[model samples]
Target: MNLLQKPILFPLNEKVRLIQYITGENSMLEHIELSIYDIEPGGKVSYHEENFESCVVVLSGKVTVDVLNGKIYSQLGTRTSVFDKVPTHSVYIGKNRFYTITAETKTRILIAASKTDQSLPDNLIKPEDVLIESRGSYHNKRYVQTILSDQDTISDKLLVVEVYTEGGNFSSYPPHKHDQNLLPKESILEETYYHEINPTQGFVFQRVYSDNRLLDQTMSCSNQDVVLVPKGYHPVGVPDGYTSYYLNIMAGPIKVWRFHDDPEHEWIKDRL
Candidate 1:
């Protein structure tokens, strides 16, 4: 059966230059820009504003991230990811100018910040604030480098965070929505879920609006299957058994999210 039948996804077959900005698809939450990114062993992504709340996840090597505010190389989460929401200029010093999976991507999602996204509060949590959360699965009770999570300290200009649930673990269980303005503390942030399931087997279910029929999408994603949730009340359903994970890149008008449940399954919330 076909698993990944969601939105549009563009793949890269080659490497990117040192300073290049490639546009990504226009998702509901924000406009995206993806690049392969090259650092000369001791180079940094443009010294631009933390504008756009960007994220850099190491796919295959090591990077020493440094902030200008006396915050030296804070964390070395090689084989993991790092996130920073505050406004600060960063410099990434790599081991060499060789080729490894390093990505520089920006998200347009914002909350309580100017559209230009050029504001900082002076002192943010130290580089130590940038912590790496593992996002992988366990095989035979042995850990495998599958999934990880690294969230920013500011909790403002959010970027992408990786989440890996057990192959059969149910995440985002009951269907829900983030469009309810009434529950600002609950349902307010737009989301974009990029999936990576194990063995590329099994399927994930996501449902949007429907005039008469449910605009549901069942994706059996492998390496690259992206689903952009702009403004629909959505929920994810992981089948009975399947190791699953996704890089959830989100941003919106509000800082936090409180999604509402579908009327039919609203009862599940009480028991859960």
Candidate 2:
């Protein structure tokens, strides 16, 4: 199966351009749903999910979100690009709630959802609320921002994060897999990577492989492209002279994230 999904041009319409990547039938993912929205100024998109807890992440530009016709968050984002290295604004709406996003400017956003039985309060995660960290060392260096995690009680089966990698560097390195359900050793989780290149013309390579070689694929991903990791050790590498940014949405039977590195490559961590 081709894991890389390229963007398709949508018909010109007055409403926002919505690309549904993982809406049940179109994707191999069973526990996750992802969509991206491109909205012109004054355009709006409304949605209500009956069984999934959803998160709205403002990728760029500005917007206002209204939840359940009562609570409204105004002017939530201001980044010129996802590469701004600044934290983004995100909203979490629990199951069976209605929400509308109206674009105050030309905007792009991502929605990630997963099944949940819990109904929690809505939360507007401000830029300051996101935890940013510099991970790895030397060539493996990358920036990470946690948007939603198991630590946050708002969502039951969703985890979201944004990562930035410099040219000639690697992210999700040393090859790790979380396809097993072992508690402290590993947990089963399917992931989707929404990639954006700095120059918009550059590309990156991501490799997905398993230990027994049952699944192995290397995908060349461009801007606005998405790569799915159903079950494998997935890692990304950026070419020289271009930067890489990707928004990752993960979900599984269990909410916690535990990964085990490939045994052969596990020695690299000891040297680091």
Candidate 3:
């Protein structure tokens, strides 16, 4: 299956230029929907979800989010590039809520959604509230920012995170899969990776494959490219001279994340 999706350019006059990375109508995903919106200043995008919850992540510039009931969140972002290596701000909107986002400046946002009936209050996630972790060691090292985790019952099935892999490094290393719903072992989850290259012109290599090679594809993904992982052990490798950044959105029947690493590559963990 061809899982790599590239964004089609839209004219600047279009107040809101949206690229639907993954949606129920377009993909094999069962629980997640991902989209990217590039809104010019003074532009607005509104949404009302009847049976799904969503989280809006600011990738660049600033914006204000108004959740219809006179609740307004203003100036919600900073940093002009994902390469800034800074934690971003995001807003979580529960099912049955109506929210509008107005760009205070030229802004880019990523929204991830999943089916849910959880009656959670809408909340804003600040940069300081994000947990930053450094995983792996040496060349396999990568920095991770956890946006939403299972510990936070505020969300139903969505798990969001941002990762930064330095030049000539590896991420999602030792190839792992979470496509089985066995508690304490692995949980079934479908995921989407939205990638951005530091130099913009550079690219990263991502591989999606099953043990029997039933599903295997290695792709050269550029900026604004999205990769879907329906069922497989997926991993990424970055070429030298350019850094790679990607926002990952995952959803499944279970909220927690547990994975099984490929036995062949499991030994790599010992060296780390």
Candidate 4:
């Protein structure tokens, strides 16, 4: 129900923690953003989005979706994911109200006064299309996966990876960016860094711009923090003894895994 503007911080607690919508409207990617809902034991949110596609993942407790597939309410399993670009489905939490993330996949265009067509858009994914990767990508390479994302395999592919590192830095030593267009097999993808440093933890500075003299500026990011990267070259720096993680959501017009690092930091590539 809300779009993230500035990074909102959430403290770690013994009980369940809930961080609602990351953004309101424009804050979402392609009108899609992550929603974290906290539900109490036996709590439930009625399913019924006139025009919204929801995908649910259980980070903690188990949840069952008394879903309405065609006619009857088909009960889904724990950690059940649904690309509900079809109809409005309600959510009912189990023992403890669990958190649910909802992203809009169905394309709904406006026409007249609040009234528009309800036909399923081309991007509207089927229930089966919500593919979940149990075992993530890149186990080593000094990387860790937090969130399980269903990588979009459409024409233009943007890979979203929630990565964490132990005393290890990501995108370290090298600053990179791709600001061009190429064949589907070799295209350029923009990079953005929204940092989240643990509390009682040190700070991390991110430098972004078009190389040197490209309007250089650094921002101090911490827990529940964020930084936007539309274009230009950028890199992240995490001091020692601190752990960190980030949600890198991507989308392009092609289905290829290609990237280009900044000229200065490209040297570290050979070591990897």
Ordered by lDDT, highest first, the candidates read: 3, 2, 1, 4
The candidate maximizing lDDT is 3
Candidate 4 has a TM-score of 0.54
Off by over 4 Å in 2: none
Winner on lDDT between 2 and 3 is 3
Q: Could you estimate the TM-score for every candidate?
A: 0.57, 0.97, 0.97, 0.54
For residues 1-272, write the lDDT of model 1, one tens digit per residue.
12233433322223323322323333223533333343333334433333443444443234444444434443333332222221222222121111222233321111111122434333322234434443223221111221112233343444444555554444554556665577544545556566655546666665555223355544444434555555555555565566555556555565454667667766665654
Error of 4 at 13 (Å): 18
lDDT of 3: 0.90
Where model 1 places Cα greater than 4 Å from the true spot, the runs are: 1-25, 31-51, 66-75, 78-118, 121-155, 200-203, 210-218, 239-241
In order, what lDDT does every prediction score? 0.41, 0.89, 0.90, 0.39
| Better candidate number, 1 or 2, judged by lDDT | 2
After superposition, which runs of candidate 4 have C-alpha atoms over 4 Å from their true positions? 1-5, 9-32, 37-61, 65-67, 70-141, 146-158, 168-173, 184-202, 211-216
| Winner on TM-score (1 vs 2) | 2
- Name the 10 consecutive residues with the lowest summed lDDT in model 4: 106-115
**lDDT measured at residue 127 in model 2 versus the true structure, 0 to 100:** 94
lDDT of 4: 0.39
In angstroms, give how far residue 74 of model 4 lies from its true place. Answer: 11
